[model samples]
Target: MMMTPADLDAFAIGFMLTERLADSTRDVLSVEPFEAEAGWIVRVTLADRCRGRIHDRVRHRTSDTGCGLCGIASLEQLRRPVAHIPPRPRSGARALFSAIAALRDHQPLNGATGAVHAAAACAPDGTIVAAYEDVGRHNALDKLIGATAACGVPGFILVTSRISFEMADKALVASTPMLVGISAPTTLAVDHARAHGLTLVALARADAMLVLNDPWNCFDAVAGEGLEPPTPGL
Candidate 1:
């Protein structure tokens, strides 16, 4: 089933704080949905230790399709310091294609709705460890993070949507070493990936992919198969 805004927001707030706030430091009390001028708002109430308070509310405004980092009140909230990610072994083009094929095979939600985005965790060898789908790309990632929080699945993340700054931030928060996208990434996303030592790949297809940043060089294409190299200067 497609995720409701309330469910999406709950996962987002819950997991977003999972790294920043220790489980003993905070707890999500409730998630309520409300109508807003911009879109539907998911109000998350939490018990916070930082403020020594019983109630701290964070509002998440989500569009019908679910955009990340929306309805923020300040620029400071838009940027977060990503943790340094250790390098992982290079994933060959064959492995990437296999993982994408697995993700597509398992995405029943996308097959049914054609409206959801997916986030998957793939092992170093390219096997899909786990996957989640949601109306919003961020929600998909959040759900995947929350689902795998305790499982300690160490692998790269693959998304069926464009790589946005928020997507990069979320993966970094999850301590993911690499992120692959079916579409291109924003400049801010690339910058964050570079600064945080996270490998970012995009425009990945069955035939080829682009390596936006690979500080540890954890990506490899088939020696003579799949996508041809881009011609000079587009």
Candidate 2:
């Protein structure tokens, strides 16, 4: 299916559920688009039976740029508690940097507009498996989650935007162990990452990177004393 920014909020959730268009979960009943005073609204109707519950209307209220949490009604809807991340093997700093460097080349939309955010899932060896882009960082994250949900999580996620609480929340939802950002994280994002045990790395330039939370040893590598000494060449 073709995905535009307008349909992401509705489509992304459906895409992640392992439900296809032939299945009830992703079956599209109808779609209605209308203009509101704020901007534009797209109401999507999925099939009656969807992933255990019947879904009626899922709304995507967006500006021209496709920002996030636009229609949130209460604070309760904003914060969601997630399970702590489990312990896992760490990736070397070199691998992390390699993933970050490779991420730039995958973002054609960002190169053209210079305004969109891109999210990528990279392996421990620094190969990028999937990448998605959107005007909003949250949207990019959601699309990345939907696209890579079945990949059994990756070594880390490389994002081209500042870390936020919602970003951390989404990572936990997707069972991602670590998140690396090109910008710094917010105070709430740090707290959320710590609470959920999701590693948060930010301020990531080519030369340096910061690790906010590393409960799983996903960022730093400890030097061992058992290194072999170099031999002089004759």
**Winning model by TM-score:** 1
lDDT of 2 by residue, 39-100 (tens): 55666666655534322223244323333445444556555435446346356566666888
Candidate 1 local lDDT, 146-196, one digit each (tens): 666655347688999999987888777777778989988899899988888
Note the Cα lDDT for every prediction shown. Answer: 0.69, 0.63
Alpha-carbon RMSD of each model? 5.0, 7.8
Find the 10 residues in a row with the least total lDDT in model 1.
50-59
Candidate 1 Cα errors over 4 Å, as ranges:
1-14, 18-67, 220-234
Worst 10 residues of 2 by lDDT: 225-234
Clashes of 1: 1
TM-score of each: 0.75, 0.71
| Model 1 pairs in collision | 207-227
